[model samples]
Target: MLLLFLSVLLTLIYCSHGDLIADTCRKTQYPLICISTLRSNPHSRSADVKGLVRFILKAALGKANTILNLANDLLKKTKDPILRQSLDTCISVYQDALDEIPIAIENVGKNNVEASDNASATFVDADTCEESFSNSPFAADNKAVKQLAVVAEDIIGSLG
Candidate 1:
């Protein structure tokens, strides 16, 4: 009897895990990235949609801040006007990304059902930074920013 109970319990656990993450990930463009990113977070194991969105947005905000700090650091290393201009622009992009996050969080909290998509700045801010450095010597600076932004946007889309 205990063995039978254990089998059913294990089965339920396996199915719920799929339903919580994998099934939700299916709704996004980057399902593999979504599953991998969310699953890596300790809080995600029991997170519902709002909790998942909050975790993802917070992570993305952290990445945006990192990008901002990296750009500021790069600015300190150079006196070149062109490089400084590019870095400043990239920094602004990350700042915008950071600013948008709070609004997205609030919109998610509203539970409007349609607000999350419209509320998102998504990958636009990151894309701007990436494009600014695409032909510059600062392409290396854009790498992490672009990757994190894409992951953030994908996760946000999955929420809706």
Candidate 2:
């Protein structure tokens, strides 16, 4: 888990483009992640606060989709019932998180930032998915998914 966080952290720390991205993200909890993710986008240079929020959510949504892909791939390869069930739960949780991202974007568009904030904070499902699997052989995969979820969570948490 630490390894995955650090790896993702590296991606956040470097490769940022526009100075405005870093400047705007300075108020965020995970500024590096915000800057790294936002600045790399072609549309970020002229993005306003709402645009930043949308971009941040989009980055999180991407991570959630990746988690879903990982879970689906693992599900196809696994014959163990326990692992299958856990992955199934993860799939659902990730989908929920994915759904939240679009709603958040819409909320931001409507100037309903409080609602967007609430939607962003609704990432407990991902945590629930991680805790579903204890010290099983699938622990590594669970941790990876958890880390990605954290990235998503961090992006949302940093929206303020």
Candidate 3:
């Protein structure tokens, strides 16, 4: 009877431990999938895509800030010159990447607003500006904005 009780107790603990491990793994994969989907659908105008991109960008920026804090903590905790230098470099690169996101987003917003304004100004029978706007430099800038989001994701992964 004693042996059976011990075995049952151990089995229950092992099962709980496995559950904890699985939950952690799931959490980690969730963020990766979320980021990847955002990066892939950055150009989408659908509400879902836009919301996902905004959420992912916010998450990425938050993570980047956390890394910066970690680097600062490491600077205080470690005396190794090489490690310190590497951490400094990581912080600098992360800052640059984060800084670029705002500019990219702003450019995209400006382009979209300008495009809408231009489209509205055209006479009901005028299609020339509408057609030209579709292929304008602003459209190309929109593509670049999406690419920048993907790059930001990559940068966040590297920082991690």
Q: For residues 7-95, what per-residue lDDT tens digits would candidate 2 score against the true structure?
A: 98766644343555676677655566666777678787666666776776676667667778888998999999998998898888878
lDDT of 2 at 92: 88
lDDT winner: 1
| Inter-residue clash pairs, candidate 1 | none
Residue runs of model 3 more than 4 Å from their true location after superposition: 1-32, 35-48, 108-160
The CA lDDT at 53 in model 1 is 64
Estimate every model's Cα lDDT from 0 to 1: 0.66, 0.64, 0.42
lDDT of 3 by residue, 1-160 (tens): 9999999988986665444333322443244445453445433223232233344445444544555566577668878776666666545645554564444334333344432222222111122211333232223322333333443333233322
Worst 10-residue lDDT window, candidate 3: 121-130
The superposed Cα distance between candidate 2 and the true structure at residue 39, in angstroms, equals 1.4
- Per-residue error at 34 for model 3, in Å? 1.6
Alpha-carbon lDDT of model 1: 0.66
